[model samples]
Every structure is written in C-alpha cells, then in structure tokens.
Target: MITIQYAIIGGTGVYDSGVASIQKTVNTEYGKVEVDIAEVEGTSMVFLARHGKEHGIPPHLINYRANIKALQELGVQHIFATAAVGSLNPDYPTGSLVVLSDFMEMTKQRPLTFFEGGTDDVKHVNMDDPYCGNLRKHLLEAAKLHKIQFKGNAVYLCTEGPRFETEAEIRMMRKWGADVVGMTSVPEVVLAKELGMCYASVGFVVNMATGMESGPIQLESIGDMLARNKEKVNKMFLDIFSKTLDQQNCGCADSIVCL
Candidate 1:
C-alpha cells in the first residue's frame, strides 16, 4: 500500500532507470498494470510504462482509462507524461525537447472520456488550457538551470495509430498550428484533467515529420536516437519532479463544473 504523490506514465524504454523497483501489478477495471515505485530525493513516486514493459502496447491499444484510474486510486495528484514525437517545425529537430502547452486531438476510436458508463452520468471536462501551467513553468526553469536546451512551448497534435502519419496529414496539422505531432497525449491529458490531477507533457523529438525528413522514415534509427537521448529526458524529469512538488496551487490544480 505505497502512497505516491506523482506518477510518470509514458513509453517503456523511457524509464530504464536501474533504480526503479517494481511494487506490484495493480488490477483495475480495465486491466492489470505493473506499477513501479521509486524514491528520488526521498520522495516516493510511481512510474507506469504506458506500453507494457516490453513495449508491446501500441498507442491506439493503450488502456488509458484503466491506467489513469489506477493512478488516481493510488492518490497521485500530479502526472508527467513523455512521448516520442515528430517535429512539424523545422527548428525543432531530433533529440530536441518540447514542454507541450497545448494539444489538438486527431485521434478517434479510442475511449476519450471517463464519464461514460451504465451508472456514471454524463460529464464534460473543460480543457481551455490542457497542460498544467505551474508544472510547465517549473520544468522550464529547471531546463534553464540545468543548461538543457528546451523549446519553451509547443502545440502537440495527437493522432491515432501504430503507423506514423502521412506527409499530407503532417502538412494539414502544421497549417492548423500544430508544432509537434504524435500518437499519444490526447486521452492521457484529458483523463488526468478529469481526475483533478495537474498534468503536463514532455515531447522528445525523434525525427522531423514526414516530408521534412531526408529519405524514408527509419524507425529503428529513430529508436536509437531516443535511446541515446534518454539521459537528458531523465534529467528533465528529475528536475521537474523535484521542483513541482513544492508549489501550492496551479491553474491546473483547480477544477470546473460540467454543464
């Protein structure tokens, strides 16, 4: 019965920390998920590999509702999610980091909300500003202090797929003001919001979006880059985790009524 205040849910490979110790596999309404509890500076936090430990779960196949519910049940109040994304903006190249400030959901078919059920009534969660402001600010400050080159802000586009988006889709998203493109982050952000948890996303640029990249997309090479850049990603989280816990209230910490 370990109580954790913060939870990090993202790709499996992103958390290869040798220190992470598996606490237990939490069985939820949706499915069973392995939850790892670790200590950073004596603060206990939970980590869940969004995909299974072996990276078996695809973006569209993620049991988002179950994952969020499991964390909420564990009393987690803040969530930091990471995703490997393709940069729509030329300035944001491979290995670059972006603290997502906003997101556009182009994903469908996946369950997008928690208010639907036989017993649960209809509810709408306000997302005027999706990412948690306080957490984002703290992360930016940490990046500066750590001398980590972090792009201050970004608009992440959430798409549905195991497959990457086509060049035409990327072009359309850029026109719609998207700065980054990825398959995850839609329901993940929205679910955290509905749970009254402060949530923010960190996007690690794996490559330039379709058409922008040289030659064809080589996922293996991108995976290698992400692997090489994992240290920086870990450091960013370490900084964010240490800083954000001290703040009292953020706009993201507040809640609104559904109409």
Candidate 2:
C-alpha cells in the first residue's frame, strides 16, 4: 500500500474528469474508500468521490472519518475538497465560488475528532486557521491565472442536512458571519487538521437559501446552477491540483506548532 502526496475528495464532476487512472480501494477504520490515482503534469495525484462514484450518498451520511483516515494512511500530504453549498449572504449570489477560510459547525451527532478512544491517548489539535494557508495560496494563484471569478476569506457554516435550510435559518447564519452554508465541511476540515494534512475547500454555491430567492424553494433552479458552474469548477480543480503538486515545499507542509 503506497501512499500518494496529493489527493482530492469531491464528486463525479471532478472524479470523472478522465484525468485520473482507476486505482484500488483502501480500507480504513471507518470504511473503505475508492481512489483513482494518476499523474498530472508530472505530479502524482489521487481523486476520490465524496458522494460515491454515482453521487449516491447524502451529505449527512458521508463517511468523513474513513475517508480522511484512508487518505492519511495513503500518505497524502495535502488535500483539496469541493462542496456544493447554499449562499447565506445576499452579496454572494448563487453559482459563485467561495474559497473558505473559516468554519462553524451546527451539527451535533457526527464524530468530529480522531482522539476519542478509551485506549487512544488524548491529544489537542490547534485549529486557529483550519484551512491550510499554503494550499489556499496556491489555489488563489491558480484561480487568478485561470481568470476564475472567486471570493476569498469566506466563513463556511456546516449544518446537519440532506435538506436545505429555511429562510430564517439562513438569516441566523448570516448573523453568525457565515458567507456560505453546507453539510460536509465540519469533520472534513477538522480531520485534516488532526492528521496535519494541508486542506482547502472550494465551495460552489448551488442556490440561494430557500427564502432569499423570489419564488418558493425550487429544486430545478439549484440543479441548473450546478450544471452551469460545473465546467469552471472542474478547470479550477485541475489547475490548483497541478500547482500544489509542483510546489512540494510550500508552507503547507510545515509544522503547526512552529507557526
């Protein structure tokens, strides 16, 4: 079982890019993760489908622990994750890309840490800047080079759901300083921090939270937005992954305690 240095956990929009070669499945303490490993621009990269290969899994049910654990086991040095979210701030209209910097978790039941077994020693992980700064820098640079319109310094709010939030719920998220709201960012960010893997999230806004849009909640519009932004998102991921793999000595690989 050889480990790869760069990995991406996303959906079919990314995994099915035909850029990656099919690889073996890895078993983790949490579950088995299927990764397609390949080389891009002379750099080795691995891509995994967060919602399974066919988008079959729901957000609330994603096996975050097993996914992160397996990636760590495979020697992944850094990670790039993409999520579909709803905009909480009116300024950030639907279909916008948000590079998340901070996050707040509103979920109560998912396992959020890796240091909680009776036999496992207690360890405290620092999370002041949860997203990896170096990775974020590379992404920002790549986005610029590609001329992709994006907003940085975003606060992502992780909510418990397979369902969209209500207008009132979205309003509370806005008050809490959240630019975007989604279901999978919490444990994903925290687990990467624990494993010391540099991680960054590229949030794709799929819709305006329920009440904010003129009409009542409509599923078709959200689907339409995702469909439209799919190409840009794919191109952005390819660029960022290629760049990070080239700059192996980025600040992302440094020790957090030294910061």
Candidate 3:
C-alpha cells in the first residue's frame, strides 16, 4: 500500500502510458475505481481514466463521486485532469491547449456533491475558485519546463452530453462568456473540491463548436486531435507531479462550509 498523494484523471483519448506500474482497484462507497499506481521521475502517481480505460463511459454517466472518493481513499491530495473540448472563442481554436480558469455549469441530472445529507450533516462547498489556483500555477510552470505551449486560459462551459451542442446552444453559451465547451469537468471538479483536494484541469480544443465553423463537427478529427496532444499533456502532468508540492493558501482545503 503506497501512499500516493497525486493523481491524473485522463479524459477522452488520454490513457495510461507510463511503465513499471501496478494496477489497483480502489473500492469506495460510490463504486470501484481502477487506477494505475506508477512512478514518474521517481514520484509515485495515480492515473485514472475518466471515461474508463477503454473510453467506454459517456460524459453524463461518468462516476465522478466514485472517482474522486477513490482518490481520497488513496490519500491523494492533488489532482490534474485533462479534457477534450470544442472551442467557442477564436483565440482557442481547434488544437489549442488551454488552462481551465473558470467554469459555467450547463450539466443536469448528475450528482454534484459528496455530502448528500440525511445520515451525514449537510455542508456546502465554495465555488469561488472552482479550479485550484495553486495547482494551476504549478501546472503552468511545469508546462514551461516541458516547453508546452498553452494559448491562454479558458472558461469551460460543461454540457450534459454524449452529443455535441447545437448552434443555438453554442451561441448562447458563447454570449455567457464561455470560451470552450465540453461534456465533463463540472461534477468532477466540484466533487474534488468537496473532498478538500486540490484539483485543476487543462483542456485540449478538439473541434469548433457548432456554428463556430462552416461545416459539421467531425468526430474523426476530434480523435486525431486528442491523439496528437495526449502525450504532451501527460508528460506535463508527470513533470508537475515529479516535484514536491507544498501546502498553499489555495482555499481548496478550507472550502467546505458547514452550518
């Protein structure tokens, strides 16, 4: 039982690539999360695929609570998750890598928290800084060291989908100041916060949302885009986890407000 304190949640096409690792199934109250415990640059890290190892799970059905809670059970404190998104902003066109600075929730019918009280006393988690600022800083710094170019920051708009958004939806979301659109990152990010874990995410712009371009959004192209950037993103995450992360006043650990 190794004490792994860092984790990576690979979204879409991102999957396991590290060597010399052991597979372990962490069973939580929510469900069992299968993870890879590996050493990257002499650092032990946990790798979990958000869409399962084979990319079998859909966005709306991902076991977010189980995933986050399993990490908590493993004593993990910091998490870095990747997502494939569609661009609504010209600056973050297809193939761009952007840091998640904020998020606009458009998801519904998903479990958004860990404390669904009745037996346990109810408490609320703060969403002021939805993504961990400290982890984002470390990630950006690590990106520099890895020579990974991030176009800029993005305000991710998460939609409940196994399908892409409509032109009208994209148009409306763009007006809402959303820079990128995706299916994941809402409940997942919030779940981590509720558990007092530092969580930050970066998105790979895989396509232009409907109406952003002239033709239809191509699924084939999205896969190819993710294939190209998967390694770069994973390497950057490993580099970030390779270094010792100290406690910061990010407020992620103090976010739970109880009555």
Query: Which has the greatest TM-score?
Result: 3
Candidate 1's TM-score reads 0.92
Model 2 misplacement above 4 A: 221-228, 243-259
Which candidate, 1 or 3, has the higher lDDT?
3
**Is candidate 1 or 2 superior in lDDT?**
1
lDDT of predicted model 2: 0.77
Tens-digit per-residue lDDT, 37-146, candidate 2:
88777767778888888889887788989988988888987788888777777777776888999999899778888877576655666777688877787778877877
Q: By the TM-score metric, which is better: model 1 or model 2?
A: 1
Q: Write the per-residue lDDT of candidate 3 for residues 1-259, one digit (tens) a residue.
A: 6688999999987875645778999999999999999987788889998999988999999999999999999889999999999999999888899999999998888988888788776799999999999999987888888888899989999999988899999889988999999999999999999989999999999888999999999767777778778888888888888778855769998998887
The residue pairs found clashing in candidate 1 are none
TM-score of each: 0.92, 0.89, 0.96
**What TM-score does structure 3 among the candidates reach?**
0.96
Pairs with steric clashes in candidate 2: 3-74
On residues 84-105, what C-alpha lDDT tens digit does candidate 1 reach at each position?
8889998887778888999998
Q: Which residue window of length 10 is worst by lDDT in model 1?
A: 246-255
Error at 62, model 3, angstroms: 0.8
**Order the candidates by lDDT, highest first — what do you get?**
3, 1, 2
Question: With candidate 3 superimposed using the best TM-score fit, by how many Å does residue 186's alpha carbon deviate from the native?
Answer: 1.0
